[model samples]
Target: MGLLHRFANPGRFLRLAARLQPWTNALALVLTGWGLIWGLFFAPADWQQGDAVRIMYVHVPAAWLASAGYVALAVCSVLSLVWRHPLADLAAAEIGPVGAAVTAVCLASGSLWGKPMWGAWWVWDARLTSVLVLFFLYVGHIALLRAFDEPQRGYRAGAILALVGAIDLPIIKFSVQWWNTLHQPDSITLTGAPTMSTSMLWPLLISALGFSFGFAAIVLARLRAAVMEQRLRVLLLSRGNAAAGAPS
Candidate 1:
């Protein structure tokens, strides 16, 4: 609670974010560029899938960011509900659009990857369908956040929706195991040795880190802008009230 309150100050957060953004942005570009080059050109082709497997370099990262971004959104929602953290609402508002974009990339890349591997652009497979649902959840959260004229009301409504939608995260994770899905089970697991070869795995991990950094960079930049905008609005409103109250 002490730590949360310390950083919850918008001005303090903006200063910290400003210092971190350049480093994150640079790392995102360098790592993503290097990983893509290595994965697309240098990584050995799969014995079965061959060159088509290159798409994993992009699709996998986007898939990861989509889920991870939502987790961040859900965290913000919790902070907003529990602590009434000032910055959390602003963070959630910014996260929704970015999360949606990442999810869209995941879905589009999955479709393109699927067409060659599955002989169809899409299937109603459990993993695929659940990810689609995740995308809709992002979209709905984005819309709900803006649905009310009063910002606080909208934030509260969106926070509840985000919390409710988070139930899908675990379902998305275990969908392949739980159902007969065309999507493959995870090759990488925290508890077990990765099934993927090091040649592919190294680049994939690098790309995922890069995407993670990129997502953080984007959200921080957006949050900073939002905080500044809110400050400006409040200043403007106070000035208008002051003038209206002044004697003519």
Candidate 2:
């Protein structure tokens, strides 16, 4: 309750976000720039995939964030529903479209990389199918939230759906292990060292980190905008009510 009360003030959040945004944005730009150059130019190409492997620089980070962003949305949704934190709903709402966009980029780029390597634009492989489902889940969440006339009711419903859909996240992660698929196996894991050389792995890691922070920064900005808009609407409504009630 205390925490919620403290953060509920938009001015506080705006101040914190303003301070953090520049640092996060700068880090994202530097890391992304270095990662792309290192991955595309310096890292040795796969013996079989050749230069096509460079696509991973973009595809891998996008795919990772697609899942990560949804998890964030679900968590924020839960917070909003349970604690009724003012910014939580706004954060979740702002994050959904961004997550969906990342998922779309992952799929589109994967298909582009697949056409030459896999001989088709897409295969109904388990990983691909699960990712597709994840994409649909994002779309459904967005549609459901907007469906209701009352914004709070819509947010509540969307939050529930987001929580439910999060169960698919682990399934997507394990799809490669559970079923035969065209998508390659995970390159990095907690149990063992990454399969790639330092030269290649470092850039990929940098890019992943960069993309993650970039997503966070964008979400913060969007959430701030949402909060301001809501405040403006409330102010306008109050003004209207006051005008209607004034002495004749």
Best by TM-score: 1
lDDT of 2 by residue, 1-248 (tens): 68666878888988888899899889889888888888999999988999999999999999999999999999888788788888888888899999999999999989989998999999898888899999999999899889999989989999999999998999999998988888778989998888888888999999888888888878878887888898899999999999999999
Number of clashing pairs per prediction, in order: 0, 0
- Tens-place lDDT per residue, model 1, 1-248, is 78878988778988888899999999999999989999999999999888999999999999989999999999999999998988899999999999999999999999989999999999898889999999999999999988999989999999999999999999989998899888888999998999989999999999888888999889989999999999999999999999999999
Tell me, what's the RMSD of every candidate?
0.8, 1.4
TM-score for each model:
0.98, 0.95
Error of 2 at 48 (Å): 1.5
Please, what is the whole-model Cα lDDT of each candidate in the order they appear? 0.93, 0.90
RMSD of 2: 1.4
**Consecutive 10-residue window with the lowest summed lDDT within model 1:** 1-10
